[model samples]
Target: MKRRRHQKTRGDMMKKTLLAATFAVWIFNVHAQGSMTIYGSIDSGVTHISNVAGTKLTRVDSGNRQPDRIGIRGSEDLGGGVKTVFQLENGYVTDTGAQLNPAKLFNRGAYVGIGNNFGTLTFGRQNNFMFDMVGKYSNGFLLGSFYAFHPGNIDDLTNAGAYDNAVKLVSAPISGVTLGAMYALGEQSGDSARNRAFSLGANYAAGPFKIAAALSDSNNRSLTLGQTTGIRTLLGRTLISGSAQAPVYSALATDKVRSVAVSGSYAMGPALLHALHVQTDISVAAATATMKSSELGVNYRITPANSLNLGVAHTSLNDMSWDQLTLNNVYSLSKRTAVYAQALHQRASGTGTVAAVNSFGYATGQRQSAIRIGVHHLF
Candidate 1:
């Protein structure tokens, strides 16, 4: 009788343990509930710019601190130290009511990923490591957006930067250090190297200082002739003799483009200092050339709601040189709204130099100047 009783007790104990385990799993799932959010920003400005085709131009422009955008982002907990994340953002011009890129929606960002404590792995359209690091650490971009980018945006440190069909990975910060990498497919059949691109980078942040370094490499992949690609837009009018008549890809023939850059910032009391340097090398079937860009700037917080920014930047492409100075001020009306004013002066000097103010396009002379007053709101 005692033996049978012992056997029954053991069975009962096993059943209790199984029930407890099932209850624990249910609790974990309940606690891992997912969440979603919708957010966006709108920025507009009145801009007066000069030295374009021997005429002074003035107009209403969109996006100063940031491009006008509407986005949906969310995360879903998948239990056991894993989650699903997604973001879809679109850019637009507030004044004209047109999409920033007429060819596609979500021109800014569209990505989905799985993430946990280890890191995040995402897929879809994204930006290169060089653009991500420089935008965060360079004063020209951090303070003034397009007004602060290097000439022609040769280093791709502005709103014009993006990569299609990409995979990106960013490691969780460990001990004030973080690392990220990205690879973009050129999508041309039968030629894997035609438009493939890749980037690697690392960043460190400690106390009031932050620094980042990145490297990128890309190739021309389009098979179609004469369709303007990223490479053509970046090197416009700077091509070697007789190359302009040829399609950019044919003239360069799968040109290999590489770039390396470093940027950093330091904070002291109410003032912050920022600096960056970028170097680019382009190699093609016939010739190779190098471009170098540098910038130094400072931002001072005059009060809780007001700030001032000043910066000087220079870029050299082959034999041409461009130098610029900018002053900007911003005042906050609320936590999500602000107003700003900025002034810019640039000079291009050399035998064939022309002053170009990035998004403003090429100027008629060696000197160019611009002024902008704008407002920004976030929701």
Candidate 2:
């Protein structure tokens, strides 16, 4: 935990140091120059998990249907089809009114850049293409809640996937196709590539169908794994107290890590179909770990105000395997508010592995389940 905290702290500090100049324009008030907007969402709930090292527990949860966050973003017209753009977003804990990440005030994103009709180029702390492309086309989107994310979120579909000190380019849709690329600097003094990362993605949308694909590679601990993926999963970590924790899914720290994924969604009348596949590989020093995950799901809008989601996923990490099932129901109170209930179950097999569902932590048994009831609001 301490090591992970320090890693985020270093990333936040470096991003701030590297992008201070770019953000000056934003500080001077871009709103007066053009258009600005404030936006936010809050999702809080009560959840029950069947196992946490053998004891069942119920508690309050935040960011279930959506992340709890508030942000300000704006663009200043530079004329001739060009513009200056910037955004600052932060996440908070609904239960305690605390920042999601204590390392920085804008843990979600802090970036400034230029945009044209064709595309946009941005710099600073941001998310990778993997999160952008895969998320838009994956079953995870229809599920509309973190509870339905695959076990361990090994594929990163449900992870924050944030990168600091990053430069990113995203193209506007052209003939239904959008392209994206990103790179994050490690900024290490002696060695240049110690913690560098890069990612590429493409997305296509046409009427009722959409598809996306992404590729990513990183060195050391450059990329922030999803909250569920953890930092090191292979042998686990040694705590500051000198105690050891058993490995959860198998994300061993390595010199190099690579990931590839593709996902698609189709809308048919009031029903939606979703499918996705993800592959992750680690090599060079330490031990090699490979993880593969896939999912298929469907979402149906039974009524304008009611919807249902069902999904099943499978994951294989080296010698460990996990299978999960989830069901969710939601009722829209209005365009910006909704109430939901979800249930998830996971079955684990292989090499001392125990089942663990999304955001419920670890389990001591081979079977684990969770149920949650929540409300989501946006403004």
Candidate 3:
């Protein structure tokens, strides 16, 4: 009888322990639940340029209206109203089916952060404040025409600049006002200021009027294609021929860059009017070159699914200047699909200057024009 009683007690203890273990697992599941989502966008166009190295060409291009990209984003509930989030995005060329940046798997974005009521703070490769403010408000994106941006996207207000090894903070909207800041470390050995970058931005939106402003400063940055792509041209050693495309990329290791951008928009019934200005200064070998651009644009809605956009701008680099005009029309097939057409012309004046649109290669002559039709899909 004693032996049977002892066995019964041991069995009851084991059952209680098992039940406690199961209850703990159930509690963990409730507290740490999370959700994940995948998303992407593709844009392709058939385009013709009047000049590139003095040659007229017609070709199918990728990412004319917007870059092709795929991304994954997720958030995990950490309890206590706090959540941790992450995003990974890859940019690619739709026509060639190749990665936009051969060196990176996730060239567009890769970041992780935590959030709460105060706002969100993220770390790793991320957008600069200029992109958060002016890029979002600029007609280039709002009108779905990359050519509407300034030549070479000199100020990087349209996201041509990407800062790596960075930390960013964005505040929650307060009274229709939002503010953001970002800092990127140089990561150079024994020198903290060699290749560092920082930016600040502010935005205000109330009803039909919106305004945004941003400024960025960099120290001893690299020579980059478009200021974002790390591809390096042989500008340092090779003597560029006269017929070669002029230097439009970011500055070299001995150079410093500073950019300021301001943009505003107002809605008037079916039309939205926009104004934008950008100033960029690059210090190279103790010589500073300044470029300034000013633009006016409007988007008119013909119907709920069709719209037209017009943009005109002038950019000056000392005695050299360019004037640009663009027209963009878009028709929506659905919430996630659209077909669009764009036309652009640019005229250059001043000694040794050639015409070049933002996305197109340089023209050998003083004038350049392009026309494109494209389809866009988002998923």
Candidate 4:
């Protein structure tokens, strides 16, 4: 009887151990299945302007130094090293709690795709190759809002809006390199010639050096309203005479724009060097013109909690040009909280025009300069 009882007890112990082991395996599998995360940033600051076209000098408190934004991203594991992924992101004014655009909810990025060791295929509103490749390398990526360079002078590529109704495919990283391309549907039922764009890009990284190149082209129909007065007359005449391809006063019932950019970065210990060169061409009705810009920057890590950044860029329109210099310091209070101050000085040279109010605030035919300082935060 004693032997039989001992045998039963040992058997029960073995069963319990096996049960616990099985439960542990189940838990591990569940944990490895997938995850979803919520992330975003809230940045706002006060800006003092010395001169704003059609407005008096003033100081205004504004939101979106870095552009307040929120995003939801997730991924689900599938068998065979494949996964399903999606992201919905939007921009808003944190101070006012208002959407940047009431018309659209996910104004920043809204895409769904399948990703795996083979790469990712995504659809919906997403960033273009130029923005992903060249824009990311600019000093503006670090300056938040106080810097005039926040969005690079290629306003036509960055500001016209994120690509909508688009489909994109990215190749798996191989030998430390990846390639991507995208196309927009134009959304026209029959005539697909109204407004359409397409882009392609490739990036390679090896050791401490990385390089990226991209090209994008867009076509749109434009109508310009002519005003026969003052500068408007001069600009209108220039547009009509084909001397300049100004967007105003000229009816570009059809317009085409192309951009090319190359960016690279090199890292050495706590110091890094970055640079980019971008060129854009616009063809509208009987007008064709080109704009070129370049940026060079350096970043130094002073400590675990602080860093210093300096950048310079030169923008030119057919020999006429302007240069901008920026200096910034960032101090981190925590992983999700930080404070920064950036100062920018822009000067115009040659016969280049600056401060036009179209998109990048770069106007043609005027020489102008300004400075800005502000802060940014993320969570």
Over the full model, what C-alpha lDDT does candidate 4 score relative to the true structure? Answer: 0.66
| Candidate 4: tens digits of C-alpha lDDT, residues 1-379 | 9999999999999999999999988767755787777788876554444334434343434442455788989888887999998999988876578888898899888999998898899999988888776666666664334353522234333433378888889898799888999998888879796578888989899999988898887778342312211023221234333233433444434377778888888989988888888887767666765668788898898998888888887776555566777777777788776676655556656542444321224334343333334456676
Instruction: Name the regions of candidate 4 deviating beyond 4 angstroms.
Output: 1-33, 54-65, 143-161, 221-254, 350-352, 355-373
lDDT of 2 by residue, 310-335 (tens): 88988887788889888889999999
lDDT against the true structure, per candidate, is 0.79, 0.81, 0.81, 0.66
- TM-score for each candidate, following the candidate numbering: 0.83, 0.85, 0.85, 0.77
How well does candidate 4 score on lDDT at residue 293?
Answer: 79
For residues 1-379, could you state the per-residue lDDT of candidate 1 as single tens digits? 9999999999999999999999887666644566666798898999999866568999898877887889888888888999999989889889999998999699988999999999999999887888777568775666865767876565666545578899999999999889999999888899887778998989999999999999888886222112211123233432333353342343444377788999999999999999999998766565666878889999999999999989888888677788989899999999999999999998988775678776675676788899999999999
Local error of candidate 1 at 137, Å?
1.4
Worst 10-residue lDDT window, candidate 3: 225-234
lDDT of candidate 4 at residue 114, scale 0 to 100: 95
Root-mean-square deviation of Cα positions for candidate 3 versus the true structure, in angstroms: 9.6
The residue ranges of model 2 lying beyond 4 angstroms of the native Cα positions read: 1-32, 222-252, 284-286
TM-score, model 4 to reference: 0.77
